[model samples]
Target chain A: MGRAILTLLWKDLRVELRTKEILTTMMVLALLILVILNVAMGQNVVTVKLAASGVLWVVFTFAATLGLSRVFLVEKERGQLSGILLAPMDRSAIFLGKMIGSTILVLLVEAVALPVFVVLFNFPLGGRVGPLLLPLFLGTVGFIAVETLFSAISAQTRLREILLPLLAFPVAMPALVGAVGATAKVLDGLPLQSAAPELQLLVAFDILFVAIGLVVFEYVVEEE
Target chain B: MVQEDRRAVEARGVKKAFGRTWALRGVDLEVRPGEYLALLGPNGSGKTTLLRILATLIRPTEGNIRIFGRDPRREGEECRRLLGFVGHDSFLYGSLSVSENLHFYARLFGLPDIPARTRQVLEALGLERRAHDLVRTLSRGLQQRVAIARALLHDPILLLLDEPFTGLDAQASRSLGELLASLRQEGRAIIMATHNLNEGLEACDRAVILLDGRVARVMEGPEIRGERLREAFLATLES
Candidate 1:
């Protein structure tokens, strides 16, 4: 199982390295969203700082969804998912491998988007980078775990482009809300303990979805 | 070996339905070790559905399927390891080179000495010269050959091919036929679903014709001759 999971992750990364299709689109879209929001919010630094966390999530969620939707669609389009399904491993391995790949891609996009986000919003990091990384990492994993499964489920449908966001956003609302709250506290320069409630939710969300995804992903991609 | 173990595939009363429509209903079939069986039918006649079920890509809505006497429902991983499937799709990454695609599947299957196995399959398929070419840059015939090499990488006991000769020219088709004959010579049990009457009939020891998701005719040995099986196929469907 470990070897198969790693091989799948390796395959995704190797293909992406050659095409640069998913990451390039994700990064460009994230940057565009950040630039537009910065301009629209105007020169009000105080207001921007207050809204930065929510705005950041909006960028990440949309970019993450865009990338997540394509991850399975490519396999479906090329009919490679069937080939991968033929591998002699637990089907959950595919889900975990895909979720990990998505987590890495979203994080890479966030890495670039973060500096630009701070520069444009005029938000001060103030040595809070450590606290901020927690929410970003947890939040990305939480939603991606959910999105990756939905991406596989929806990739089987004809209206997958429209169906993926619809199915994912509602299921991921708790994590998204929790992530926003935690990011808000960190941006406000409050102690990380103060955001414990939201952080706890983020952690719980990550565990719940990852568990559910592993169990049900075999069924989701089974028919294909 | 046990009598059941001597059979490469055994499916009983297998039925598959998608919503209100049934693709395969009450389908019973069997193939012995070292046998080549051809499945022939019109479109929507459930050839692909049956292959997918045996491939363990999809579960039958009803009934049971066993690969080498082990049920796929209980031992899917084992069943999958014993079989290699080539559907209509090449399942190759267009951005990656031919060797890279084979290497990826080889690793996924956890084959030891990946480079040696990869090189052997490449040379066997005559893909050695084009190993470095991107899959998208290759012709459809070459891509199909690469897909076959990918299937053969794990050295499976059974091969399930669906419409493998669909779009190939005469030369490509003839070469593919030679490859299948060689694989058969090595004692692999093969179940090929094809629309090419002459190629499919000539190559199979037995042929099953499906109509409306049920086995309508089974021609064995000398009964699988070209004109006779073709007439039987048309007659079965006409009924």
Candidate 2:
């Protein structure tokens, strides 16, 4: 099992690195959203840019959905699900590898985007930023798990690329709400204890979404 | 009917329906160890449906299936470990090179000496030269060969092949024929669902004809030859 997960993870990570499809597109999209934010917030003076941090995180979360769907699009287009299913490993391992791969891709974009946002918006990203990282990571985990499973399920259906976000974002609203709420506190200099419930909610979202995905994976893999 | 005979795999009065469309209307058949059985039928005749039931991919609406005396419905995970399937499309991840695909599955099957086993399977399938090639870059025949290798990696005792010969050329089909024969020699029971009647009979010890989701007839040995098997397939289709 360990070997299977590692190999699967290695395969996804390696291909993603070579093609640079997921990271490049997502990073560019994140940057573009920041550009739009600068223009829109330029007209306002109510600390809209500061509030835009939460807005920007939401934007990244939603935009990352596109990258997630595209990641699996190659596999589905090439009929590679059958290949993964036949790999003689626990099907859950594939789900985990995909989740990890997308999570890393999202984080890569996040790393660069944060510094750029801090520099451009000038909101002092270090105001208890150490604590804020927790929500970002939790939200990313939940977001990726939901997206990975939906990608697998939607891969078979028609309009797969469109269907992924439709299924993912609606089912993921709870995590989204929790991350936004918890992050607002982290950026405002609250202690870790103040952010605990929302953090816990994100964790619950991760665990529950993963469990649901694992249960339905066999059905999605079965040839209809 | 649960025949008291020594059966390697058996399905009794199995029925499955998807929505209002009934795919199988009580499919009952049995094969003992080492038997090569071909399931012949036209599309919508329920060949794949019955195979999936035996594979425990879905439950039969009404009926039971046992493989080696174990109820597949109740013991799907165990049944899965003992069974291998190769279908029309090989489900090899195109991004992963051949060796990585083999190694990944080896780990999934929890095999010790994964490198050795993967190497052996690749060599046996004559894929050693292309083991580093991405599956997307391989020819259809080569990809199907890799699909067969994926199935054989676990050394399953029972094999279910759905249209396994679809994209293969003569040589690839012959190699596959040889592989199944070798498995039969080692006491494995095989079930291949195919539309190609001629090749189906040539590869199997018995050919069972299914008509609109039921077993219509069974032919064995010398009766399964040349155009004769195709005629049987047509008869099943007509019925």
Candidate 3:
């Protein structure tokens, strides 16, 4: 099972590396959002500080959805999902593999966007970079966990392009709120403990979705 | 040795319905070890549905199916371990190179010495030269060969092929027929669904015609001659 999951992750990463489809689209969109935020907010330190967390998450959420939707769309379009299903491994392993791939891609996009965001808005990072990493990882994992499963479900639908965000946004609201709160707290130079509640919420969200994704994934992949 | 006597595939009263439409109303089939059975049917005759059910890609709306004495629904992982399936869709990732695609499936099946296994399958399928080419860049015939290689990677006992020759030219089709013949001689059971009556009858040990979700006719040995098989297929469809 571990080998199967790793192979799946490796396959997805290799495809993305060659095509750069997911990363290119995501990075461009993130940069565009940052540019829009810069134009709308106009380098006002006080306002930028207050809106930075919210804008960053809002952009990440939408861009992540765009990337997540493609996670399974490529498989569905080429009918490769059937091949994966035919493998003699537990279906949850496929979910884990996709979730890991998506999380990595989303993080890469975030990593690129963060520096540009900081420089664009002239926002202060102070010395809180170490404390920020945990929330970023947890939040991204929680977001991708839910999005990956929902993307699979939506990919099977005729209106998948529109259906993915519709199905994912409401379910992903809690995680998004927690991420924004944690980012805001950290950016404000608050003590690590100050964002502990949001971090806990993000962790719980990740666990709940990852558990549900494992159990429900088989049914989702089944042909109607 | 005793396991060889076990039916490679067995289906009784298997029915599959999509929404209110019944693709397979009631079907019964049985294939012995080392037998190659060809499934012939017109469009919408439920041939693909039956193959999908046997592959465990979809569940039956009613009745039962057993692959090597194990129920697909109850023992899907085990059934999959014993079965290999190739359908109209190549099931290969277009963006991945041929070798990469096979390697991925080899790893998924947890086959040891992945590099060696991948090389062996590629060589068997005559895809060694094209192994590094992305699947999307290959011709349809070559892509189909890669699909067959991926399915054969795990060395399944029973192989299910749906319209395997749909897009192949005469040369590629003949090569594929030779490969299936070799596999059959090696004692692997195979069920192939196709529309080409002559090829189907030539390659298979028995031929079954499906019409309106039921087995309309079954022919074996001398009864599976090309002209007779086509006549039976036409007669069944007309009726």
Candidate 4:
């Protein structure tokens, strides 16, 4: 089981490394969102600071969705998903592998996007930035778990690009809210303890989405 | 008492429906170990659907299927281990090289000594020479060969192929025919679904014509020779 999951993850990462399809698309979109938002917001330090967490979450969510939408569609391209499904491993390994892959791509995009965001908004990046990782990481895990599952379901549809966000955003709302709230607390220079409730909510959503994904993803990918 | 005597596949009353339409109403078929069976049918005749169900890619709307006596629904992982499937598509990633694609599947199938197994299949399919080339760069025949190598990586006992010769040139088709003959000789249960009746029936011990989601006729031995199967094909569907 461990070998299968790692193999699946390695396969996805290797393909991404070669084509750079998912990561490049995600990074470009993240940067574009940052540039567009910076122009619109007009360097209002107070407004930018207040909306920073929301802006960050919005950027990550949209970019991650764009990337996640292709995660399973790549497999569908050459009917590779059927080949993988015909392999003798537990189906949930596929979900975990894709979720982790999407998480890694989203995180890499965030790593680059965060700095540009700070520079664009003229926000200081002192000790306050340290606590933001927890929410960002946890929120991504939860967000990816839901999106990866929906990505599999949506990839089978004719309108996959349009369907993924519609299906995932509603389901991933709690994690988004939790991440934004926790990020807001962090940006405010509050202690990590002050953001405990939001952190807990993020953790809860992560556990719930992952657990449900493990159980339900197989059925979603199954053909009628 | 030998494993060779056991049935490699046994499906009974298998039915599959997509909403209001039915793809397979009741498909009862069996294949012995080392036997070659061909599934022949017209468009929308449920050849692919039946293959997909036996491959466990889709559930039958009704009925039971067993791979070497193990229920596919109850023991999918084990059943999957016993079978290899090659659909119409190559199923190889265009960005990855031939060797990379095979190695990926070898690892996914949990084959021990991945390099050795990957090397063996690559050599078998005559893909070792082009192992480093990206799949998209390879000719269609080579890509299909890579797909076959990936399917055979785990050394399954049952092999299912759907329209494998659809796009092959005459030479490539001949190569595939030779490969199928060798696999059949190795005692693997083979079920090939193809529209090329001449090529499809040439190497098979038995053949079945499917129409409207049911097996309309089964031909064997001398009955499958010459123009009989083709005659039966047109006659069955026309009726």
Best-matching candidate per lDDT: 1
Provide backbone clash counts, one per model: 0, 5, 0, 0
What digit string (tens of lDDT, one per residue) describes model 4 on residues B94-129?
A: 998888888888888888998888888889888789
Cα lDDT of model 1 by residue, A1-224, tens digit:
88888989998998999899999999999999998998899869788877889999999999999999999998998899999999888999999999999899999999999999878877768799998999989999999999999999999999987899999999999999999999999988998999999999999999999999988988899893
Q: What is the lDDT of residue B58 in candidate 2?
A: 61
Q: What does the lDDT come to for candidate 2? A: 0.79
TM-score, cand. 4 vs. native: 0.97
Candidate no. 1 TM-score: 0.97
Q: Is candidate 2 or candidate 4 better by TM-score?
A: 4
State the lDDT of candidate 2 residue by residue for B171-221, as single tens digits: 888887887787777777899998776454565789888888888899997
lDDT of 2 by residue, A1-224 (tens): 56667777887887776677788888888888887787767635357534854765766786698798887678767656555654445667777778887888888888888887766776665657788788999988898888898888788787888899899888989998888888877776678789889989999999999898777776775655
Question: Model 3, which residues run further than 4 Å from truth?
Answer: B1-3
Per-residue lDDT value at A174 in model 1: 98
Where is model 3 chain B poorest over a 10-residue stretch in terms of lDDT? B195-204
Give per-residue CA lDDT, model 3, range B1-239, as digits (tens): 12466899999999999989999989999999999999988889999999999999999999999999999888999999989999888889888889889988988888899899899999999999998998999999999999999999999989999998888899998899999999988889999998777563475899889998999999898877767777777887888
Q: Spell out the clash pairs found in candidate 1.
A: none
Chain B TM (all candidates): 0.96, 0.93, 0.97, 0.97
Q: TM per model?
A: 0.97, 0.87, 0.97, 0.97
Q: What's the residue-level lDDT of A154 in candidate 1? A: 92
